[model samples]
Target: MFAPFAPMLRRAALVPSVHRLLPSNSRSLYQNIIKRHEDMATEHGSPSSSGEMHDALDVLSSESSPISTIPLDPDTDYAALAIPSLQSKNKANLPPLMNIPPQEDPLLHHIASRIMNHGERAKASRTVSQMLLHLHAWTRSPPLPILRQAIFKLSPAVKVIGHKHSTKMIYKPVPLSEKQGIWLATEWILDAIKGRQGGPTLAERMAREVILILKNESKTLEKKEAYHKSAMMNRGNIAIART
Candidate 1:
C-alpha cells in the first residue's frame, strides 16, 4: 500500500513540471522563435530546407509595416537587364523598309516620239506659219487649192532685207514686234531643215519662235508710247510753225 501511494505522488509532480515548461501561449512563442532563428541562419549563409517559409514570414512582416513602398523609376532600362543588349542594338542598325513605286510610261512619251520620228517641230512650225499666211483666203476654213501646190510654199520665208533684217514669218504673233521675229525664226528653221542642217522636227521651233516674238513685242510696246508722244509733239510744232 505505501508503494502505490509513492507512484501516484511522483506522477502528480511530473504533471506540474511539464505545465510550467510549456506556458498557455507556448505554441505561438515557439513558432516566432523558430522563424527568427531561420532568418539569422539564412543571413549567416545557411540555406533553409525550403526558402518559402522565410519568404512567407517576410511577407507577413512587410504587410504589418512596410519597409519600402516607392515605385520603381520609369527611366530604368529593362534592355540593360537582358544578358546581351547588342542583339537589340544590331536590329536597330538595319536598313529601313520601303515600298518603292514601279517604273511606268512618261507623260511626254508621245511628244518625244513625234519629235524623234517625224521631226514634227520644224514641219509643224512651217505648216502653222503657212496657214496663217493664207488666213485672208481661208476665213471660212475652206479647202485652199494652193496648200497642196508645193512644199516650199508650205515653208517659212526670210526677208531679203539682208542678214541684219532676216525676218521669218510666224503663225501666231500676239504682238507686232513678235510678229516679225517669229516670221524670221520660222524661215531660219525651215532653211535649216531644207539644207539638212536641222532635223525635220518643227513644233519645238514654232514654240520657241512664238516665245521670242512675245518677248520682242513686250520690248516694242515701250518704244511705241515714246513714238506716239514724239509724233504728237512734232505735229503740234509743225502746226505752230505754219501759223
Candidate 2:
C-alpha cells in the first residue's frame, strides 16, 4: 500500500512550490502552466557549447566589419582627428639611429653641445663623430690630429667691439681669452655651415668646411682674416677699450 502511495506523496510535496509560482488555480490553470513549461522546454532545449558561442561572435564581428581599411593620409582619418597626437603623422618614419658619439673629450663635448639646438643633443653628438670619420677618410690618418689642427688654425685671436664716441661708433680690437676664442670659432663655423648652399645635413657640410679649413680654402678662414683686418684698422680705439 505505501509503495503505491509514493508517487502521490511526491506530487503533494510539489503542490506548494507550484502554488507559489502561480495564483490560487483551478484544474484548468494547472493544466495551462504544465502546457507553458512544455512549450518553453521545446523552445530552448539546451545550453550552447563554447564552439557555438565563438561562431556566433565571429559572425557578428564579420557583419559589423565587412570592409575594414586604414587610410594612408592622416588628414582623412576621421576616426582619431580629435586627438592632437594622431592628427598628424608626427610619429612616422624617423631617421635611423645615430652611431657611437665622440664624448670622451671635454672639448668635443663642448663643441657638440654648441652644435645641439632645441635640446636635441644626440644629433649634435653624431654630427661631431661624423666630422672625425670624414677627417680620417680625407687624410688617411688619425682624425684627432687633423681636427685639432683645423680648430687651432680656424680659431681667431681677436674679436671686434664698438664704442660710442661722439656720435660715431669707433671699432676696437679686443683680445679674446681662450674660452672666448673657442666659442667664437664654434659660432663662426656653425654660421658658415648654415650659409652653405648645398648639403643634406649639418654634419656633412661641417666636415667639408673643416677639410677646407685644413686646406686654407674655407670661408671661415676668410672671415678670420676680415676680422683681423678690421681690428688692425681700428687699433686706435684699443686705448678706449676696457682693460
* Reference-based lDDT, each prediction: 0.43, 0.73
User: In candidate 1, what are the lDDT values of residues 1-243, reduced to their tens digit?
Assistant: 688699889876665323345555774575687678877878888776337665654554332434567787799876677736677777879878897854622212322333343665555344555543443243434322222222222222221221222484322212224334333333443443343347633543433333333444322233334434544443422323343
- After aligning candidate 1 to the native by TM-score, how far in Å is the CA of 78 from where it should be? 99
Candidate 1 local Cα displacement, residue 180, angstroms: 12
lDDT of 2 by residue, 155-228 (tens): 88997988788999887898878777778778878888776566456777777777888888887888789888
Query: After superposing candidate 1, which stretches have Cα over 4 Å from the reference?
Result: 1-217, 240-243
Q: How well does each candidate superpose onto the true structure, as a TM-score?
A: 0.16, 0.52
State the number of backbone clashes in model 2. Answer: 0
List ranges where model 2 is wrong by over 4 Å. Answer: 1-103, 195-200, 240-243
